[model samples]
Target: MVMENEEVSFADTVFGFWEDSQVHSVNSSNSSNDEEENYDDEEETFCTKEKNKAFWEEQGQLLQATLCRTSSIETKVRHATKEALGELNASERRCICGQLEVAKAKSCCRNCLDRDIRDRLLSLGFNCYISKSKWNNSPGTPSGEHTYLEVIDTSNSKRGEVKVVIELSFRAEFEMARANEEYNQLIMKLPEVFVGKGERLRVLVKILCSAAKKCMKEKNIHLAPWRKQKYMLAKWLGTYDRSTMETLPRAYTNRPQKPKTSMLTYDLLEKIPGLHCTTAVEVV
Candidate 1:
């Protein structure tokens, strides 16, 4: 009977030890799992932060490089464009379209402004043309038409005619609603007036589109089709037609004040004998 009691106590001790060991093993396993999970989370967060920083830095570098590049032709065109914009804006001609108010509200008198600039560029002896890009709605962006200026440089005969595209509203092209701060800053780096070679503009378009993609991804927003690189490049680099209308004579640009007995504004009295000026000259 003593042997039996000893055996039973020994069995109880063994079971207790086994139970405690199992509990400890489970706790250790849970601790290891928790540590691994925390490590993974931290690593992932760090990677994401580093990726975002690198993307913005890369974009800034690309933009700066593209903007810094200039050729003699590009510089001349840029200067002429800036001067034209300044003078045109200073003397903003109201749209004389039938619906003046509607035209002004819609395009802010863009027709006259564009025409005036084109004329000025032509007078400046640049092979300027009003180019129109039209695309059909396919698997890509929607069908639309865009009008902008272009200058063809034939000075580099060895390399052939170089096309320098101009965008009066360059910055607005890539603007997005609800865009992140980084994306907006990149957009701001673009000049309000962009005058560059086709290759330079193409590179800029790619950079902006990629940055836009990252920004929208971070915000969990779907990137639009038009914002894609291909679509944006199609604006200036794609197939288009150039309207090579004849520019007026430069002499016509400079009209003299009327002689003492002549017309001041138009040659109405001279051209049309039926029209006559007032007997008394009244300066208003």
Candidate 2:
């Protein structure tokens, strides 16, 4: 009987020990999980910072390299484009077609501004054209169309024709609403107006698209279809229809009107019979 009682007590003791160990184990596990979570958050923050820094540095290098490789024709076109913008800024003219402000490039009347710039470029002896690119809705990107200016240079007999793309709102186009500081700073480096060769423009597009993708990834947001690299490249590099916009009339000017006599009294006297009786006073 004593042996059986001892065995029972031993079994009970073992059970009690297991229950106590289980309680302590749960508490330790909870503590460990919290520490792990904190460590993960810290690591993520560190990685994000490093990534942003690296991205900005690499982008700067790429932009510098791309800008340095410019041709004589590109430089000439760029200067001409800037000169055209300065003239528009100083002029007090409105586009005849849109009847909108063209004094500033960022005017609400974007169409008018574009048309005016194209006209000015043509007048400056550059073979400029408006390129309209259209794409249908695909699996990834939606249907869209884009219009921008291009200056074609066929001056060199050996090099053939060179195409220079001009974008007035180049910097504003790449700006993001939910961008980090690094991304914003990188965008600031871009010119308000971009005038470069097709190859340079292509490189810039790739750089900006990658930056946009990184930004959205860090922010945990889905990038818009239009912001994708492929979509952006399709805008300029894709098949496009070109037009010189020669059909549009030139901007009308406000010329001085000739002084005329007041015919209001004569018209009223002739048209209105006895209903309107006017007393005419002669000035001596």
lDDT of 1: 0.82
Alpha-carbon local distance difference test for all models = 0.82, 0.82
- How many clashes (backbone N, Cα, C below 3 Å) per candidate? 0, 0
Give the Cα-based TM-score of candidate 1 against the true structure: 0.80
Worst 10 residues of 2 by lDDT: 99-108
Q: Give the TM-score of each candidate.
A: 0.80, 0.73
Those runs of model 2 whose alpha carbons end farther than 4 Å from true positions after fitting are: 1-48, 101-108, 256-284
Candidate 2, 69-101: lDDT as tens digits: 888888988898888778777655655665563
Q: Write the per-residue lDDT of candidate 1 for residues 1-284, one digit (tens) a residue.
A: 45644555777889999999999999999999999999999999999999899989999998998899899989999999999877655552444443343222224455555666788888899988889898888796877778888999998789998999989889999999889999998898889889999998988998899999999999999999988987888889888999867443222122353556534666786679998687897889
